[model samples]
Target: MIFIPLWQRLLVALATVAAILLALPNMFYGRVEVANDARASIAQGLTSPELEADAGLWPSWLPSGLINLGLDLRGGAHLLAEVQVSDVYASRMDSLWPVIRDALAADRDTVGFVTREDGPPSELHVRISKPEGAARALEIVRGLARPVASLSGGGSSDIEVRAQNDLLIVNLSEAERAATDDRTVQQALEIVRRRIDEVGTREPTILRQGADRILVQVPGVGSAQEVKDIIGTTAQLTFQPVVQRTSNKDADPGAGNILVPSVDEPGVYYILDRAAVVTGEDLTDAQPTFDQNGRPAVSFRFDPQGARAFGEYTGAHIGEPFAIVLDNEVISAPVIQSAIPGGSGIITGQFTPEESTDLAVLLRAGALPAELTFLEERTIGPELGADSIQAGKNAAYAAAVMVVLFMIASYGVFGAIACVALAINIVMIFASLSLLGATLTLPGIAGIVLTMGQAVDANVLIYERMREELRRGASPVKAVQEGFDKAFSAILDANVTTFIIAAIMFFVGTGTVRGFAVTLAMGVVTTMITGVYVSRVLIALWFARTRPKTIVV
Candidate 1:
């Protein structure tokens, strides 16, 4: 007689129950989501009557993990942004000015008097007093060139220096530019991801596209504009010594100075030094706080090097006005009253509470390396997502109903048993998705429906084998054992091949394809557990109770 051990039956029963419990949260998705958000807020030291009520909606002891819905399923904003990589070239040239100036100054006898000459933003031009000293200036600049910090740029220098008559022209090398482009895109991707995560959105898709573009998909956000507003801020903060205040937007601040408009004051501008005393890159921490007058502001602390430099600069230039610039606009120009040795300072402006909070978030997330120009943007509405969900449910229900009827009509009792295993298989798939925190897209639903149909294949193989065994004059007990044993190899082979393809699809593909692959791969595993083992346990229990001598084929 066929026998499934008591331990095996109990294990299957326990696992099936556990899967059902884990997938239970999805049934009340909205309530559970609210409860989760409330719990998260409470954990962060927040309290409110409404939050407390929401937190009590779900029991803490039960599993609260739910499958994350993908952007296509939940509705969200999608953006394709192209990084302005050329902007970095200008910044690089600007930074190189001080280094080149200092280097040429060290050899004043040979290089003579050096003065920065205005030219293109992407190139630095320094005219020397002595025309014959061009060769020496180029030599000094070339000596300062460092090796590119990338494997592909081995033995290549970061800067290419050449002498154009009396002027020393400097530009970034091609290899260095390529490496910088890659790093800029990667840094932008990470900063964008951090900004989105700060808003507590789930399963956002942030990925690099091509050479200089990024694709961002944030699910459950209000609109594309909202998503853009969150990540679009450059947050380029700098503190520069103020040259003077002016009202003329067309006023040239002469060499080594820039004109920036005021953030709070209309028509007013400040001519500030081109070189900054400290930048946002030196900030270690930032948070929303209030100024001395109880006005909304952002407080920031700097790193050790920045702290030392700021303290020395403030001590040397007491009572002098310094412009706090952000994204080419002056936020405020405050005079230094005392040396700020503590490395902490407040940024005051005509800011609302929400604006202060958002500025804090942006400062904490760090500045984007370069600007992002939105090439494409799309916003999906919740109503559309609801319709998609309903359609997907209808498709799944239809597939399940058709499969159930066909299985019941085909092999009588055995087919009915297979339908039960199929039900368990579906539960296991959802449970796996929940546990993995995977996003389920519309394609994922198609995968589940496909799994339901394929789930009965193993049962069909075993039942057909049993029919052959019965026709060969074997008793029901022997036929049952042989049927399972003979069908195991074929089932294993089929699932193994399908699993390989699914793995390939998962690793190589992105977005929707990956969602489909995840469900398909999970189905393969659950099918094996239910179709072969669970069916055997149920059949064995029936045999032990009924003790049938013969069975219909």
Candidate 2:
């Protein structure tokens, strides 16, 4: 330990210097964050002269990473939402009506007239005029069963269509329901992530909870209500062919048609075909742009198949009006002036620039599979977070001071060396956190304070071993070497056991506990480096230059 080679010593020194440099950004986090944001904006062509100046505040080559503060530290919104996954079941059965009707109508001889039977919302019940035809109807419907393509229920049929008495019931099978529930939750999670990211929030925590719930924690957001508004809109966009345009609010729109109120004109309603010509799922991209009238509008491009279908529909119905519906409200009804062969079109409405931008974002993100009910919500104030941060800083300083004073009083010059190593260890911890983009919470700060004591444990063992060696009349260099060698087993064993525990906590814990685990895990690795290798290098250099024959312990 006392005789570290020049190459190894230089490598350790360079690494320590690099870690300190990487951690420097955290000291000026506000400026660095502004600079980083400006740089990103410039990349997106949203740059102005003011933003470019901000970008110059921090050089691009420097380490721009900063430790992300968790919701607890930064003060933001927390929301727990329960997804209504079963709601999709009713719609699924309703959509199967066309397929079932078409299939049975093809074999009309024995099936006779097929009418939908009023039954459970979870099931599709259709009665055949001829009871004897139930078996044949079941066979036709069962032929429509699709293989479940899911991780949970792979290679199984997605639906079960069976004959019960005079009625044929169609519903999702057990395996299929499990698969559907999983998919609904996954899609909801992705949609929520996209919506939040679209709003430009940093480091939002969105994760699945239980079977049909989501936990969202967005730091730096103003309120839980703001986040809820962004994600809760549903924003289901669809294009339907207009059957009739009317001024009557209470007019019967006929079966298979829906009466939707116009968004700009409150009293006017449009009766649109129940089946959609295209949906937002077909959209490939959407951007806020000016229309031909120089008004704010949203232009959307479609995927290949959607583009083909849309182009054909418009080409065939040149002079007919189509309603652009959003969440059951008609945003606009415009006649197809000509065939849009390029698969892109613009949506014009009485929209401001902000509204157009938000709608574009919603279109690009896609729709949620199911509606979410906010079960719990809370907004944390910045004042409380500031207080917590101040308290954490005080605790850390007190711990560092006490540890440093104790080390100085006990081990003299060796204690001073240990203190330097401890300081380097703290820098390394922050560097690691920043590099990993880990969120720092209050509990994580507590972990740092705890690590302050642990950082010097190896030094304590080494110094005591050195005293023992000196008592045996060993030379200073030999005593240092034996001290490090003897304490190696104890240091390695203690750190490894604690590291295992930290790993367990990191894997099993959630939220604050996981944050604590992250800091503790990082601290353990940094402690091993600074307390063992760094301290050894510093002492080795001192001994090599001094060539001391004997030393007081």
Candidate 3:
């Protein structure tokens, strides 16, 4: 019999009801947030200000924060980023590879290196074919490695250049040492997001494109160039010891070729010649305001230790110019006037309100833990979103009408019952998405329509089997029961496979693929439950009440 245990029956009823309830918010009340120009606001999280276009449509009873359709359904920004983890790693390795090659070549008799095309440990092939002085060669090779302070402390490292038979692996180059960490993808995304947020870009869509790429979509953005700038800037801030002043140093001002840039051009910053004494990482807060003399300036606070260090340094260096450098550009170089005991100080530059705000944002976001460079970028706007939504809707309606008509023709009266269940299934799917906050994409709409067509698969299997049973002269009740019983396993196998594919699509696919996959996966699940179990219950209730011995066609 197609009959389920009472518990199974109750569970189905409850699940079906819950799915409907969950999707209610998205279907009715959820509105896609729009930018001031009624376009998609991709980088919404970046900006603090509200755009003119953010409006919500929701049931009066829904919570104020609860209702809003996502980009998946309403056709908002969609981007696919391919994380180039390997690319970045290779580029870094290439930079240091040459240096290591040169070092080894210099000691050709003792050590020479080669790189494998593909191998584990990302090894470099090495040869100690001729050992003029093996110990000295190894020492020089080791000296090539500098301590990776971020990795740990108090240790010096030489580049991993040693002979294992004919091959020696360079452990990691200076550049590669910075690159070898796991979680590069996550770190890259966070840095990109931080840059976007600093720019006050609104509703930005940032997703991992592949293993190493990032897809970024910024809606309500005026210029893609500006968005690109924000994404690309490294903002590598440093604090350097006030280089010991040499008398007459001001005559040349270009000491040792450390060309300091104008403070206004934060992008032009570079490293100072002297060693760093403190860094932006120690900065607690920064604000754009006037100093004691009332000139355009910035006041910065320091950590407990930085405060002590700064106080001593300023106190000793009174009457000497302290360079306020950012990105290697001297925004301000003011002479120490007095011993400021406090951990805080000010730098007043010829500045504007806009520049001040930008600086403030950058400082607030915190400096990137390491430098970052963009390999790729992708963007989609609201105009495209609207067009996609319309196309999706038309396609959906057409698919639905076609499927509904086909079902009626194929199964006659039983098809009519399935059709009613199909409509319920559609409603339940939407309600479930609305509730779960699932995003719907063009592919997702296709999933819905495809599932709609296949919703009848289980019902068709049962009815066809029943007809065969009836033809074989089985009793009507037994024929109906056996039909469902025999078809259950086949129905399960077919739908389960589709669900697995959908799951993979969601996991491996980012952005739109994920949205579509999720919708498809959910739809397959809903169809099996509603199409098979729900329809059977309603049909059984009908037959039991009527007790028809010979069913009319």
C-alpha-based local distance difference test score of model 3:
0.62
Model 2 regions lying over 4 Å from their true place: 59-61, 113-121, 127-132, 151-156, 162-167, 246-248, 251-255, 315-319, 337-341
Going through the candidates in order, what is the number of backbone clashes in each? 0, 0, 37
Model 1 C-alpha lDDT versus the unseen true structure: 0.91
lDDT at residue 438 of model 2 (Cα atoms): 90
Q: lDDT tens digits, residues 399-486, model 1?
A: 9898889888888777888998999999999999998998999999998998997789889899999999999999999999999999
RMSD per prediction, one decimal? 1.5, 2.4, 9.3
Candidate 2, residue 446: the lDDT equals 94
TM-score of each: 0.97, 0.93, 0.66
> Can you rank all candidates by TM-score, best first?
1, 2, 3
In model 3, the worst 10-residue window by lDDT is 33-42
Candidate 1 at residue 237, lDDT?
90
User: Taking the tens digit of each residue's C-alpha lDDT, what string does model 2 give over 212-280?
Assistant: 999999999889999998999888888899999899999988655678999998788999876677888
